[model samples]
Target: MNYERQPYRRCGRSGLKLPAISLGLWFHFGQERTLHDQRAIIAKALELGITHLDLADRYGPPLGAAEEAFGTIYRKDLRGLRDEIVVSTKGGNPMWDGPYGAGNSRKHLLATLDRSLKRLGLDHVDIYYLHRDDQETPLEEQVATLDHIVRQGKALYVGVSNFTPERTAEAASLLRELGTPLTVHQPQYSLLRRRIEDGLLAVLEEHGVGCVVYSPLAQGLLTDRYLDGIPAGSRAAGGRFLTASDVKPEVVAFVRTLHDLAAERGQSVAQLALAWALRDPRVTSLLVGASSPEQLEGNVAAVDRLGFTDDELAFIDRTAKEAGVLA
Candidate 1:
């Protein structure tokens, strides 16, 4: 791996540095895909300096299948590169039928972390995140459990995902007291979804926590694929997180405008969206997932044109607002 080609950013106050774009295994890496296909994607990612692979217990058609798939690849191809890679997995999402199968309880967090490590065939993960907030559980209890995980050497750092600014502040303070400071915040952020800009970014900066954002392309909404209506086999056509209703006539028109803007910049709409996501200094990394090596290469190209003028930023903001996709 040519480390010099892949730029790394410091993760907030932590000494660790992550690639500008990290590969996410949240989708398209399950039983439906063969090991050979998964291997190619992973191999391409590492070759491109994307060493941070993000996973969660709740990912995959069947919960935990993604981890198992990655485990197979790790045992066969990535074991030797373990020290050079950053493997992050999250718990606190529903993985089973019972109450203990989900949420931020000590029992659930510890139990899921153990299962994840077993699935990945790893003694420890680089970072373990509490997937979401559990209002029913005490904040102290959740933070303490993460503290315990780090203390036990099961996870090197801790993070929170899908948490509000207020909860993030509380968790950071608690973790600081526990001597395992929060390393990062994983939120849904992109040009189309700018909710983090309201207050989340400020909170993270105040506490010196890095931001690793997901859905930086708004699940392909910011891409050119949706300009001609939801194509077959697209996420919107699948009616999962994205839907036909999401691609209203007006939204399609807005996407066309964004496409034109991207063309003016001599890049694809996807590349422009990714560059926009990384434009934030507070963002430590952008989590991107790909189904093919070609797609992965297209995404990595965004790094080549990350800079944007003040006028371009203002134009994006104005266009996003008119498109009604401003988070």
Candidate 2:
């Protein structure tokens, strides 16, 4: 934990500042991983000045488990240092089998926030997000609910995730009308997934909303973990969300190129991928997850050296186009 940590950035025009590298409890923060492992990783992150910890209602093997685990950590290890951390949680992803259990309806979002608070063992969270756009629900209702969450003091700031450019723009406009500023937009963006670069980035920039992106490593495919083949205990081997079908020969060849580039820079592919994502000035933070302390340490170290030359960025763009991810 003696390594260098990067500077904090303003979340858009908001007065709040977030670390360049944030930790997401999306994976391995559940019953599948030991409590000791979770504590160690989180402890290491805190020691390295990674102040933000991201969570969601549907993050565990079974829903709600990750929040419960976080509650344990909050009460046991991090209770006294609450003010030093930024805790963000999302709802509206459908936790159960009822009509009202999902969507961005005021009923679903408000009720889910209460449950999320209980699970996190907190009176309020720093940020609460609408996990995804509820197409069925009108944009006005979604904005109102988010505004209400802030007004009630249950969440300090409001955000949205997995939303299209059009929807994001609409939500931003609505939130502006209500005087509740949209602080952040969480999306999946990486070298391999440049879909956001098309319009999403422009939408966010136009609205002055910051972005805290996820999957910058593309679930570990952007790393050397799959260079030769799927290791026995790799995420692809688990076959849950990512599977063997994802690790094709073409992907291996592409990863090899990334590996070579990273070697030339004396960094890991994971580090290079993160640096590339952080290059965006609108990207307020990078949400990363790790299964072990070693992985966390290595990933956090990437922040120590985050600069990329003009030639390197151009090369990455060309390689991404060649890989069919960008055009």
Candidate 3:
């Protein structure tokens, strides 16, 4: 892989520089996919200069399977390239049946991170994130646990995911007090999902916390996959996170308009969506998932036309609002 070809950005104020596009193992790395296929996807990602791999303990359909699958790939193919890779795993979502299966409690976080490390077959990860906030648990305790993980050398940096601006500010303040400032924030940001732009981006920028966004394609709705209609075997068809009911006729019409716009730019809707997310300087990287090598390659090419005209941005905003997809 020619690492120099991929653009790297500073993770907020951190010394680490992450590739602009990272491969996320959140989907299609579970039992539904073959091990060989999963390994091949990862191999293709690395060849495309995608150095960052994101995973979560609860990502797999059978919780924790994704990390286990990544562990196999890491030991077999990526062991020697460890220094060149930035592997991250998150916890704080339910992974088991017991009380400790989830949340930001010190016990859940510590135990899950330890188990994740063992599953990844690595002593330390580049970043460790509290997957979500546990309001029942004191914020102080959660931030302290993250600090503890960094001090113990289990993870090089700490981040938060699915946190609001107020919560992010509080966590950043606590981590800064402990001399381990929050490194990043993982939020869901896309043309369809604009909640982060309301205030989270400002909070991250003010606190110097980098942002790595997920669902940039809005679970494939922002892609050509849904431009015509819900394709068979699609995520929406599976009734998982997205559903057929969620794809209204008006939404498809709006997507067609966006698709036409993408064609004018010589890009796919997926590529346009990726570029749109990257347009914001506060976004350090995009965590994208791919089912095949070709898809991964196409996504990596989104960086080729990252810039957007003011008219394009305005049109997109107006169309999204018209379709009622704006959050």
lDDT (tens digit, per residue) of candidate 1 on 1-327? 657655799999999899999999987888878889999999999889998999999888688889999999999999899999999999999888798988899999999999999999999999899899999999999999999999999999999999999999999999999899999999999876788988999999999999999999888887888887678999888898888898877667777887888899899989998998898889999999999988988998889899999998898778767767665
Candidate 1, 290: how far from true, in Å? 0.3
Query: What is candidate 2's TM-score against the reference?
Result: 0.97
Model 3, runs deviating above 4 Å? none
* 1 against 2, candidate with superior TM-score: 1
TM-score for model 3?
A: 0.98
lDDT tens string, model 2, 225-275? 998888998889999779999887767777788889999999999999998
Show where candidate 2 strays beyond 4 Å: 1-4
Better of 2 and 3 by TM-score: 3
Model 3 per-residue lDDT tens digits across residues 1-327: 768656899999989888899999988888889999999999999998999999998878788889999999999999999999999999888877788878999999999998999989999999999999999999999999999999999999999999999999999999999999999999999887889988999999999999999999888888888766778899999999999997878778888898899999999989999999999989999999999999999999999899999999999988888778677
Report per-prediction Cα RMSD to one decimal. 1.0, 1.5, 1.0
lDDT of each: 0.90, 0.89, 0.91
Error of 3 at 198 (Å): 0.9
lDDT of 3 at 146: 94
Query: Would you estimate the TM-scores of all the predictions?
Result: 0.98, 0.97, 0.98
Q: What is the full ranking by lDDT, best candidate first?
A: 3, 1, 2
